[model samples]
Target chain A: MSMPENEIREIEAFLFLEARLADESRYDEWEALWTEDALYWVPRRADLDPAKEVSHIYDNRQRIGTRIRQLKSGFRYSQTPASPMRRVLSNIEIAPAGADEYEAGANFMLMELAIQSTRNMNFWGGRTLYRLRRVDGGLRMVVKKILLIDADEPIANLSFLI
Target chain B: MGMQRTIVYDALVHRDRVHGSLYTDPGVFSDEMDRIFHKGWSFVGHTSEVPNIGDFKRRQIGLQPVIITRNPDNEVRLLFNRCTHRGNMICAKESGNTATFVCPYHGWTFGVGGEMRGVPLQNGMGKDFDKSAMGLANVPRMRIYRGFIFASLAAEGPSFDAYLGKARKLLDRACDMSPDGEVDLSAGWLKHRFHANWKMLPENNTDGYHVNVAHASLMRAVNAFSSQAFDEDKGDNSVTRDWGGGHTELDFAARYHQTGRPFQWFGGVPAAKMPDYVARMEQAYGKDLAQQHMIEGPPHAILFPNLFLAELNISFLIPISANEVVQYYTPLLLKGAPEVNARALRQTEGAMGPGSFLLPEDACMAERNQLGLAAQSPEWLDLRRGLEREYMDEKTGLLSSAVSDEITNRSFWKEYLQLMSSFPGAAA
Candidate 1:
């Protein structure tokens, strides 16, 4: 049976809002959308185990908090002249993962314009797999795995979150 | 009646400043590739990368394509990836296991040990063609020290030990930190590039003066993010040492931090897991050794020309041109300790990843520096911080300077001046 329209709409709204919050740099709101114990990972290479290989980002809640704090505290040199970003998330697919948990996969393309003393414009496209848990009748992200198309290539500074 | 002689690279470098053209000139970049990268012993890949027989890992050394493979006798061999037939690249895969690499162009195959084994059409070359005589050209010199592999293209040069000199101790310390007496490099790599001369990276590695300005934001954020207190200004608590042969080290304070743990950032590993991890380390290395390992912080060691070891990661620079360089950052794992390895991998990603907070700022600074070098107004870049405070060691013939000093850069330039002055192309 096909998923109900309401459920699909709910998933779409949730994903879009999450992307909007990140792009808008509303870090506190973004943090609130995550479950207490969350695993956020951006792999260096596709299909590599985090335990065996390295990742671009592999932060639990505390590590995530650290990154957020860095961004928010105005002390992150890379983000001093924080990049203005716009994220386009599409091709979203959602399905039940476990009890009260849903798995969502989506493709995203983010354009960021960073202006420090100089201006650097960056474009990044990636696919994201998110495991979201239903808490208090609302969906909260448990894990976010971002897989960039050119993970193995020698990329420039990706200071901003993808 | 005194005769005067001119040294080729003497004018390029000065006591406290170097010519800006040295950073932006393409001719200078090419000369560097030939004189420094090609002639010197540059790090290739580790032995653990191809542990099993017939396994191969591809590497490029100053435009020369090389393949590191495990031979049938279980020995490591470095071979040129070029095919003898048409010079097509033999192995394109970054890394894999295969007994024979068949050239797609003409079906010529070579063994993992670098011997030409088979040809699709044998009759074409005639029976007089010597199969055994034609094999892949081997790199002139290949040396393995503590599982780290370094390759030299020059036929004659100083021995690897002579080249390493006091820098060998840094490698030993990194290896000894592990209970197994060896470090594992099986973890994959993080590749990045910045718009600056490749030399800027090594200089930046030991350049403590820029910390407060270039990385002020990162330090401030890290301090604010963590519950633990930190002395962000680490200059007073550290020392920069020059170990000759362009090798230098930044030994930061171990007081505000613990070593051998991989992750130094506050809130790095879970608090409850710290004791258990320490217990595991103590169980494996005994109490005293483990204690020493924990207290003795990891030194940021930069081997002349290319290799750099920072904490649990070994990053090497491949100079593409005057303004572009590719960096391969491989996070090393402790062999026996899974927890430590896991932590190392995570922390390495956070520290060196493309999206890392620290390196991005450094990259921006490098790009800015490169752009600033183009300005003819300021013809020199200063390296004169704490120059007068440097003290030479009589025994090892090394130099030590304050942590905030640019002595590392000065020492590196000293070796650079020597090599570049003696360079064949420079003399020509």
Candidate 2:
């Protein structure tokens, strides 16, 4: 069965809002979008086991909070000035996963200026599998699993909220 | 005739400071690659990476591609990844189990041990080709101190023992954490690319002084460290140590031991949470020794040019250029401890890699420092921080001082200066 047009539009809007918060480095507002049981994963390989292998990021809810807090701290030089970022998200596919939940996949290409240090423009593109749920009248992210093009290879500092 | 300016490392490296050009000079970087990484020993992959025969992993020995594979005799081998037929990269995959590495360029197949097994057009060559002799070129020296592998490209220089020297104990300290006296590195590495001099990686990894400055974000965000900020007078016993022959450590053992609590070095993990890990350690070693192991945990040390025993993580840097480096980090998992290993994997993600809380700041600072080196007015970067207070450690008889000392930096420069100055093809 196909997802309703209205439901798809709502999901797309939520994803766009998330991208905007993350792009602008709005830590508090961005953090508010995640549910209590959030799983933020960025894997080195799409099929690797986290129990046996190391990943770029494998943060649970507590770790996600800690990550956001670290970014908010004034002394985070990696994000001191924050990388001036904007991203274009496309090819969004939304599907109903379960009761009051939707699994959405979108491709994003982010242009981030590493102004804090290198000042070189970094291009980051990845496919994100975001799991969202209907909360107390708004949508909250339950998962943000990013699969980067070069996740297994050497990658620059992703201290930003990717 | 125009004058040819010869680079002098002796003039640049001083007792209290070194020239800023050391970070920005391409010639200095080339010299270091030849002298340090090629001629001397550097850490390769661990044996656990390739358990059975035919298992292999790709590695680098100073920009030269090499493969770490297990031979038929179950011995560790370091094979140059170039093909025998033509100069083609033999192994393209990062890691896998393979019967033979077949070069797609010329159709030459090599065994797991890097022996040339077959030629596609055997009759085309005038029958003088010796298959037995035409194997992959092995690195001149290969040593396994515990399961950790290290190799040197140059045929002869220093003995691996002399190269490793007193720093061997650091490996022992890391391996002994497992009940089996083994450290498993089966977990794949997360490569972190940063814009900095290769030397900066080693210096910053164990810098006892930078935690409060560079990593103040993590400290403020979370109650991470044990409030043992580097004031010697504050009864905090952690020290910055120079373990002779360039190896250095920010030893938090004293701080962990002072608490008299097991696993203080491991984020104060309660023994009750890991019942099997605790029980196994006590079973293998005596109760006293195992308890002691728990207190000290793994060593947070830099083993000279490469390799970081970063407490619960293993890291090594691959120098790209004068201003670029790619550092690889993996969780230092124990051999038999499943519960502890699981925690270590998550901990490595939160603390070490590109997306982590702590390391990215260090990367940013290193990159900034490299950029700062471009200003030519101030010729020197000062290494004079705890020079007056440096004293000998009673046990190791090596120099050690407050956690916020330049003992480690000075020690690195001393060894570096010696190698660069005395190198065979140094500038005239």
Candidate 3:
């Protein structure tokens, strides 16, 4: 089923909000965007049929929370001179998967300026099969899978959310 | 002016420390390519990566591009990736199985084994043009230790065994863990490019002092495993021994601690399975070595110039630029191990894989160190940890060690200095 114009605008707005929160390092707000059982996955292979290839980051809500806690913790040395990153999301295409669920596809570019190093950029686009459910008068992400173009290529580190 | 800069290289050398310029200098880096990378038996990739006939992979040996392929006869061959006719890259993809490689630039084709098979517009070339003589230039010498392959650009060097010296025992033990005494590279890998001097990494591996400080997060995560096996009453400590010619091993007693906490393998294996693994290891190596492998914590073994065969996996540090290095991690499994055992091995590798809980922390530390080196002050970095215990053993010609030692780093630099110096008796 085709997504309603209102639902499409809502996803684009949601993605924009996510990009701004991450860019400003407001991770707490970003963390609040997910459902209790939501999954955030960055697959290691381009055609990451989850049954076959492993994911780089396969975080459920609890795991994602733990990551946030670590990032906030002063002891994480890699974040000493914390990396600054900005995510650019564009070309949003929203389609209905169920009555309330919608699948969103968008092109993303994450540019990270690690302290004392030149800017490193990661570019990729994929359809996000989000099982959005209405909860407390807001949409919550049930699942997010990021299929990077160079998923199999050697990467330095994904210190921040893409 | 360039000659004056060359003199600056001589001035940087000192007894206790070397200038940071040595790590940052382009001239020094180029010289290293000629002396160390080009001359030494640098690791390419494991033979298992190209197991089937027509399987091939592209690898960079220093700045040169080379392709390693398995011929129809099952012989492993390493050849320049470029087509001889037009200097076009023969194999563009990173890795794949191909019956023949055709260069898209001008239709020059080569066989899986790098033999020149065909060229378009063959009639246009004079009859004297011999295609038989036009095969891809093979790397000067290639040798395999077990299933691991190393290629050298220079034709002459010590035999592979002689170069490995006592290090062969370590590789043997790693391979012997499998019942079949072989290893396969099938579980896939993690490749990352770090913005740091390549030498710093090899130096860091054996530098035990950084574990408590640089990798504190990883240490914290693995603390649960360490606390259980540690015997506080034993008072056994870690040791870093230099196994001459730039190879070294950092050994920690089964219960040694950093930050007053015992060191542990990051992944936890069940107590029940440990004995079975030990028994299998005992069968592979004799009783004494098996006991050593089990009782002693895994050793951090660094084969100088860019190969690190750690207890968990193998990493190749290929220098891409002065400040950029590509790190490739290949998980090694004992050949013919049971499927369940392979799964366990994969789990262990996953704990250190690209998306592992540990690598991000390690990469962060390395990058931070690189940033620190860019500073104007602190011209010399220190490597004086446990300097007093770097005693050379008379019988084996190896250097013994103690806890908190930089002996391995010192040994690495000693060889680095020797390699960088111009060949004696040869005129400039």
Best by TM-score: 2
Mind giving the per-residue lDDT tens digits that candidate 1 earns over B375-407? 897778888887888888575476886777888
Question: How would you order the candidates by TM-score, starting with the best?
Answer: 2, 1, 3
Q: lDDT (0-100) at residue A149 of candidate 2?
A: 95
Give the top-scoring candidate (lDDT).
2
Worst 10 residues of 2 chain B by lDDT: B224-233
Candidate 2 error regions (>4 Å): B1-5, B226-228
Candidate 3, B1-428: lDDT as tens digits: 35623423345655457778777777767777777788776788889889899999888898899999999999999999898987888788989999898889988888999888988999998898888898888999999988878888988865677667788766776676565677776555567767778887788777666655655544454445334322223454555778767888776543433432211442444435445565676687787765554444344688877878776577778887667787777555655545424444444434454455556667766666677778858899777766765777575566766645778888888777766654442123
Indicate which candidate wins on DockQ: 2
**B96-155: candidate 2 lDDT, tens digit per residue:** 998888999889888999888988889987689888998999988999989999988888
Candidate 3: misplaced stretches above 4 Å?
Answer: A4-13, A32-39, A48-55, A59-66, A95-102, A116-139, B1-15, B219-236, B256-266, B273-299, B336-356, B371-378, B392-398, B422-428
DockQ, all candidates in order: 0.60, 0.92, 0.36
TM-score, each model? 0.91, 0.97, 0.85
Instruction: Give the TM-score (vs. native) of candidate 3.
Output: 0.85
Task: Give the distance in Å from residue B421's predicted Cα in candidate 2 to where it truly belongs.
Answer: 1.5
In model 3, how well does chain A match by TM-score?
0.84
Task: Order the candidate numbers by lDDT, best to worst.
Answer: 2, 1, 3
The models' CA-based lDDT, in order, is 0.79, 0.89, 0.69
> Comparing chain B with the reference, what is the TM-score for each candidate?
0.90, 0.96, 0.87
